[model samples]
Target chain A: MKTQSILLKQRPEKTPQNSDFEFKEEEVSTPKSNEVLLKSIYISVDPYLRGRMRDVESYIEPFQLNEPITSAIIAKVEKSEHENFKEGDYVLGHLAWKEYQVAKGENLRKVDPKQANLSAYLGILGMTGLTAYFGLTEIGAPKEGETVLVSGAAGAVGSTVGQIAKIYGCKTIGIAGSDEKIDLIKGKFNYDEGINYKTTDNMKEAISKAATNGIDVYYDNVGGEILDATLQNINRNGRVINCGAISQYNKDETATGPRVEGILIKKSVKMQGFTLQNDFGEKFNEGTKKLAQWLQEGKLNYEETIREGFEKVPQAFIDLFSGENKGKMVVKVAEE
Target chain B: MKTQSILLKQRPEKTPQNSDFEFKEEEVSTPKSNEVLLKSIYISVDPYLRGRMRDVESYIEPFQLNEPITSAIIAKVEKSEHENFKEGDYVLGHLAWKEYQVAKGENLRKVDPKQANLSAYLGILGMTGLTAYFGLTEIGAPKEGETVLVSGAAGAVGSTVGQIAKIYGCKTIGIAGSDEKIDLIKGKFNYDEGINYKTTDNMKEAISKAATNGIDVYYDNVGGEILDATLQNINRNGRVINCGAISQYNKDETATGPRVEGILIKKSVKMQGFTLQNDFGEKFNEGTKKLAQWLQEGKLNYEETIREGFEKVPQAFIDLFSGENKGKMVVKVAEE
Candidate 1:
């Protein structure tokens, strides 16, 4: 049998283009002992992948040239030689951008389609959700009656963060690139206020108006001037959780904005950054259980902008930098 | 009796000059029901005082126009009217830059001169020491074998920070303006390495060479290019303690360096700033007792740049900006 895969063809200088990826067909072999043959159902395309494209040392290893790009994917087990996994079970694994993949059973986590949508395992009940949970609760630590301002509030991790902050009894303010995002976050995600950074002339002034009590926690997803502007309104002992800097991901040079050390000194602010495996590897089961419970209780809501077919995976990733997706960006390859 | 006090004659635009202060003789009044007559012994001149001179809302209120600048001072109770009564008892209080003054008994904490030198109460065994202890252990939290890079390592807080980090079994690298500071930190403060930022053409290169491993903690005292330079070398999960920004205090404009939000995101670093009262108001006694214990165990050593006479208090404060002090900058006003 044959499976189509996307491979990294070239290293991008700035923003990645469709030409940077090459689509090819590869033969799928029978699963070896302790391995499972996965039929890919969905593949996640995240903004953090932009960092993996560069030939630099980062939180994770950079994707090597001419290799099939890999990420979190929801797959069905077509064949299994491992004792832990069965042939008909649905699983989530760090598999390739392909239709069929052979992965070690240990790398595959079984998911229940009955509890939540299988695609959610790629998003709200997965790494994206956990990033929001750990980064906010552990680092940001928003308190009741405090104000939390989340940048990129319409995206996967950000949307979850704003909702969770709301659940924590914080007055949540979201910053997004468009008015649509602002409305979605405010209306559907339960954010108390939303500021459209694209339309707002002065973000600092807008935030000052929205967060009248002053920002006690800043959950940052989009870094650049917005992050810089938010620094102006942070109250004493304010916390800034740096989850991702999507605005600077495609930049040719190292991104720069207003220096923060001076403001940090003045306000006694704490700004921290983290990735999932690095920070929450041990707490994954605990985090996912809580997230699942939140979803089951209908206190949490999630959205996914899914592109159909395996051929569109590369385009889906490139679209992330342009702010094309409302929530988690995923590519659907096959039916369950 | 009349006592000489240095009053703020003018608010400085940049670096404070001698003309900005006016010396006046004020009548020392007898203590009332809960007040005590205080004779100034050792007066602390700190970098944070530079912020108080400006008309800005900071952690502490800005020093009032034409009012005597108040700071940590070791004083002797010349007369007492409270039941807590003590004659010839040395005390520490937020007293003015005056040779003699009256203070409420509630603001005074009696210091035992028999335990350590009365001057030590103003430096290592006092607020300066406590600042280092809490900021380092609580925020910086440098683990064993980690590399700790401290800027302005020859100053009061920086000197103490390097020593405490050394005691924690971390490799300490210090950055200071002159070769004298570099040598002092390396030799006396027991820093593993030292970088003379003023003499070094490329501070990043210098740090790269000295800190063979990436920096795990950055104790920032003189924030400017050095703070910017150190960001490049910070390892993943690094901690940056924003103690002071003496380098930028005299600037006519808000100081700006390379924006740190992006780097902070990439490394998952936590950069935090604090003042003693803002962070450790309730835990001051606990921190000081631990500091005093370290002093008694000979696990900690301290140095002070003592400028003689109350007349030099303003000059001594000005000198802090010019990098004239080796350790804690204090003005010795009276004999023990």
Candidate 2:
């Protein structure tokens, strides 16, 4: 069989360009014993992936030179030599941005299409939902009548975080780059207020107005100036969940912003950062159950900006930096 | 009675100047019914007081323009109407920077001079000790065999933190401004290694050599470039206890450094800040008991930089900014 995969050709200085990715086709052998052949259906594109491309050490290992980039992918089991997975069974696994992947059955988790949409396994019903759940509830634990300020509020994690905060009876305030995202968050995510960062002259003032009682929980998906502004408006004992820093992901220059320790000392804020894979390893099952139940009961909703075909995976990942996607950015590899 | 007090003559822009405080002698009335007359013996001068001097909101309320600056003071009870306190009893209270203060008996905590040295009540056996205990054990949570890096290692809280981490079986590394402090921390605090940040051209290299296992717990008392350097050497799942940012206390410019969120996300570090008065209010008894037990067992030792006379209180406070004091900076207002 032949598999088409995307490879990291060059480490881009700033925002990833099209030339940074190289598409390659290779022949693959059949799955051996205890291994399953995965046909990628939906490939998740996330901001955290940018960290892996930098050849620097992080929570997740950096992508190796000339190796296919891998992430959460909803796939169909084409063939299996293991009892755990059978042909045509839908599963989710950390597979490459390719059409076919030969993975061990132990690494692939069976996904029930009847429980939810298949692509949802790569999004809200999967790691993205879990990230939002743990980061907000466990780290940014908002109380009833407290205010939650979410940066990059239209992104996958931020949108879910705002909704979760709202469910906890917190006043949700979102900050996003576009007016369209502001509207999406306010209308769909039950956010009480939304600040369009692109139009706002003063983010600190906007945050102050939105979070009148002060921000009790700050779900930080975007860092840099927005984070600096959020630090100014935090209440005493505020929780800052540092889930992502998409704003600085592509910056070539040294990352510089307002010193955090001083403000943290002044306000007694708790700022913690984590990647979903490590921090919530054992809690994924619990998180998945809660998120799935929320979706079933109509308390949760998600959006995806999916690009068609395997070749567009790089573009989908690059578009994340430009704020072109509304919610979870995914690339569809093959027909289910 | 004539009471000599130090008043805040001007709010300092950066480092507090001696001229910012004015000494005045005023007539104070005797205690009526439940009030007690206190003669100050040992007065605490802390870096956090510099924050209170600024007319800005913080964990503690800012000092008023022309009010007598107050902090943890160990005093002698000269006269009392309440049955809880007696003449010649040693007490600790949040009293003004004055030689004599007529305060309500309810605000005073009776300190037994027989249990520990009288001056210890103003330091290791009091608020400074609690700050180190809670900030280290509660927030830092140094595990056995972990590398604990402490900034401002010769100061009140930092020296205590290094010693506590040592007691927990962790490898302790201290960073300070002077070779004298480096020697003090290494020899007295039982630190495995010491880095003179003033002499080291490359802090990152120095930290890497000292913390060969990588930093697990960072007790940050002096934040800024030191914090920026520490961020580079933190291991996975590191805990950063934001005790104080003394380095930035006198900065007139807006404090800026390497953005922390990215590094935090990459390493999964948790940075939390707190004031002893608020976060550990109820836990003080628990901390005090443990600390007192340690001291009695001869497992804990402390250093004090005492300046005698009520007239030297302002200079004592100003000296804190210059890092002239090695440990707890206290002003002795009168004889024991």
Candidate 3:
């Protein structure tokens, strides 16, 4: 079978350009014993993928040049030689940007299409969901009546964080780029208040107004001035769960530093940076199970700003840095 | 009876001068019911007193000009009007920079002179002891085999911190100003290592050598470049207990901010600042009791740099900013 793949042509300097990636064709092989051949149905395009593009020491290894970029994907097993999986079974696995993949059965898990939308496996029911769940409950540790302020709240992880804070009976406030995204956060995602940071002249005042009491938990997705503004209003003994710093990821040295660290002294705040890869031990199953239950009960909602075709995977990944996605951005490689 | 008191004549711009204080004599009033008149034996001069001299919002209120300044003091009840206190009883209470004080009977607790020296009541068994105890056990959260680094390690609080860390089976490293103080930390206090920061050209390299395993708990008494250096060398998930920032207290607006805050994200560190007056409500009594027990058991030793006469209190307090004293700095107001 002929499979389409996106390859990194050059390392990105700041914001990634389309010229940085090259679309190529690769031949797919048949499944070996204990392996499965999958047709990629959906591909996840996340901000963390940007880190993988750089040749730096991070939680995960960087993607090598000229190799098909791999990420979390929801797919259908077209052929299986493993005892546990069969042909036509839907599954979720970390797979490359291609129309087809020959993966080991152990790396893929079967998902039921009837239980939830198959695309949900690429977002709220998958890695994105797990990141939001553990980051909020374990790290942020929001209490009842506490105020939670999430940066990049219109994005996948941030949107879920606000909703989960609401589930915990917390006052949820979101900071997003556009008015449309802000509306979606306040109206669709059930955030109590939403601020369009681009239009706000005084971020500290806006945060104060949104968090009338004071910020008790800060789910930080975008670092820099937004993180600085949140620091000013953090209550004593507040927790800052740093899931990602999308704002600083693409910038040069000048845009990297945050200025409001003095508040750490005033508030006695705890700011912790973490990746989901750290939680891949024995406790992961327990966290994923709780997230699955929440999704089943209709207590959690997620949106996917998906682009059609496997060729668009690189562009979709770049869109994350541009804040173009309303929620989790995904690429549809093939029809279900 | 006549009582002599030292009053704050004027607030200083930078370093406090002798002219900042004025000595005056007043008639001692008779104690009312449940009140005891105390003749001060020792008055503690701490770094936090500098904050009181400045008209800024802090954990405690600023001292008013032309009024007697007060701090924790060890005194003997010269006369009593209440059943709880007797004329010969020794106690520790917040008494002014005066030769005598009339305090409520409940405001004093009888100190057993047989268990430890009476001067220890101003340091190892008093607020300084409690500050070290709670800040280490509660905030630093030292674990066995961990490397504990303490700044201002020759001072009252820092000396106690190094000793307690050693008791907890942690490798203790002390940073002090002079070679004599550093020698005392290693010889008398039994710290694992000592570094004279003034003589070291590269603080980060010095800290790296002293804390070979990387610092897990940093008891930050001096917070400027030392803190910046410690931040760079901290281990993953390290805890920094900000007891005091003696380095920046006297500086004007031109003082440089910490340049290593990015390490907080790199190491996922937790830095918390606290005043013993704020977080040590229930823990204060518990810590002091433990410290007193340790002193009685000969497991903890203390030192005092005493300046003679009640008129020397202001100078002793001012000397704290200049790092003149070796251990607990105290003004000997009267012979017990």
Candidate 4:
């Protein structure tokens, strides 16, 4: 059978361009022992993948030049030579950006289509949802009556973070790039208020206004001047969870902003950063179960900006920088 | 009897000046029912007190203009009406900048001058010592064989932090303003290596060279270019304890440097700040006991830069900003 894959043609200097990715056609190889052949169904395109394009040290390894780039993908098993997985099984794995590939069955987790759609596993039930869950609960640790502020408010993780914070009995405020996103977060995500960063001239004043009691917990996704502003208005003993830095992901030079040590010392604040697999590997099952329960009980809601086609993976990933997508951005490679 | 006191005459714009303080002479007040008359023996001049001079909200109250400024002081009970304290008893309390003053006996903690020097309570056995102990243990959490880096290495808290890190069996590196300070830290504080930030052209390179295995824990007392350099060289899951920001304490405007959210997110580092009384009120006895035991066991050594005479109090404080003191900067108000 024929297969299609995306390779890192050139490492991105700043924002990713279509030319940085190479599309290739190849023959699909049969599965070896304890391996299963997977056909990509829903391919996740995330802001964090931008970091893998650079040749620098990070929590996760960087993507080597001319190699296939990989991320969280929902795939259907076409052929299985393993005891744990059988034909027609839907599995989730950190697989390559390919239409068909063979992977060890141990690397995949089975997902049920009857409980939720196949695409939900790539969004609300996968790493995106788990990322929001653990980062807010473990690090943010918001108490009742406290105020929680979230950046990238309309994105997948940020939207989920605001909902969870509200469920945990805290007031929620969000910061986004567009007025439309502001409305989406406030109206649909149960956020009490929202700030449009593109229109606001003074973020510190804006944050102070929205967070009347001061922000006790801040879930930061877009890092830069907005982070500085949030730090300025943070209440005493505030917590900041650095889930992602989408705004700085595309910068060529090291971004400069106001120093935070003074503010942290003054307010006795805690600022922490994390990745899901590295920090929460032991609690992943617990996180996934809780998130699934929230969805089933109608306590959770999610949005997906789907780009259909094998050729649109790079474009979908690049659109994250421009804030073109509303929530989780994914590409639909093929029908089941 | 006559006594002298200092008042905060003006809010300083940058570095504090002698004119910012006013000296006044008056008669010492007699003790009331439960009050005791204290004759100041030693006073602690710390970098954090600079924050109090500003008319801004902080962990502690801002100093009132034309009012007596207060700090940690070792005093002898000259007269007492309370049953707990008597004449000649040495007590440690956050007291006003007065040679002789009356205070409620309940606010002071008795310090045995026979166990250690009366002046030792103002340095290694008081807030300065406790700050290093808790900040390093609670936040830094340096493991054995890990590399620990400390800024403001020659100051009271930094020197103590290096000594404690050494006792914890960690590789320690010190960053100070001069080669003399570097020598003091390396020889007396048991620091494995030192970096003269003043002479070093590239601090990131300097840190990378000294900490060949990468800095696992960074105890930050001076926040600025040095902090940014330290963050850049931090290892994965590194810890940063924001004990002080002496470099930024005197700034008129908010300091700006390279944004750290990128490094923190990529490395999943933790950065936190704290004040002793507010964060660790219940742990005071525990920290003090451990610090005292270390001193008694010969595992801890302290240096005091004492300036005698009540008139030199303001100058001694101003000198802290210029890195004039090698270790704990204490003002000797009167003989014990």
Chain B TM, per prediction: 0.98, 0.98, 0.96, 0.98
Per-residue C-alpha lDDT of model 4 across residues A155-273, encoded as one tens digit per residue: 99999999999899999999999999999999889899999999999999999999889999999999888898899899999999998888888886567888899989999999999
Instruction: Give candidate 1 regions above 4 Å deviation.
Output: none
lDDT of 1 by residue, A1-336 (tens): 998889999998888999999998989888999999999998999888888899988888999999999999999999999999898899988888888888899888899899888999999999999999999999998899999999989999989999999889999999988988988998889999999988999988999999999999999998788888898898999999988888888885555566677788899999998877887799998999989899989989998999998888888898998899999999888998
Q: Lowest summed lDDT over 10 consecutive residues: which window, candidate 3 chain A?
A: A253-262
* Per-residue alpha-carbon lDDT of candidate 3 for residues B142-233, written as tens digits (9 for 90 to 100): 99999999999999999999999999999999999999999999988989999999899999999999788999999988887788888778
Clashing pairs in 1: none
What residue pairs clash in candidate 3, if any at all?
none
lDDT of each: 0.89, 0.89, 0.84, 0.92
Global local distance difference test of model 4: 0.92
Tens digits of lDDT, candidate 2, A1-336: 898888989887799998998889998778999998888898999888888999877677789878888889999998999898899999988888778878899888899989888888888888889999999999887899999999989988889988888889989999999988988998888889999999999999999998889999999998889999999899999999998888889885377888888888888899999877788898888999999889888888788788898888888988999999988888888888
Model 1: per-residue Cα lDDT over B90-183, one tens digit each: 8999899999999999988998888998888888988889889889999988899999999889888889999999999999999888888888
Which of candidates 3 and 4 is the stronger one according to lDDT?
Answer: 4
- The chain A TM-scores for the candidates, taken one by one, are 0.98, 0.98, 0.96, 0.98
Runs of candidate 2 with Cα error greater than 4 angstroms are none
Over 4 Å off, model 3: A8-10, A22-24, A27-30, A63-68, A252-262, A279-282, B8-12, B17-24, B65-67, B252-262
Q: What is candidate 4's TM-score for chain B alone? A: 0.98
Please give the ranking of all candidate structures by DockQ, highest first, separated by commas. 2, 4, 1, 3
Backbone clash numbers for all candidates listed: 0, 0, 0, 0
Candidate 2 clashing pairs, residues 3+ apart or interchain? none
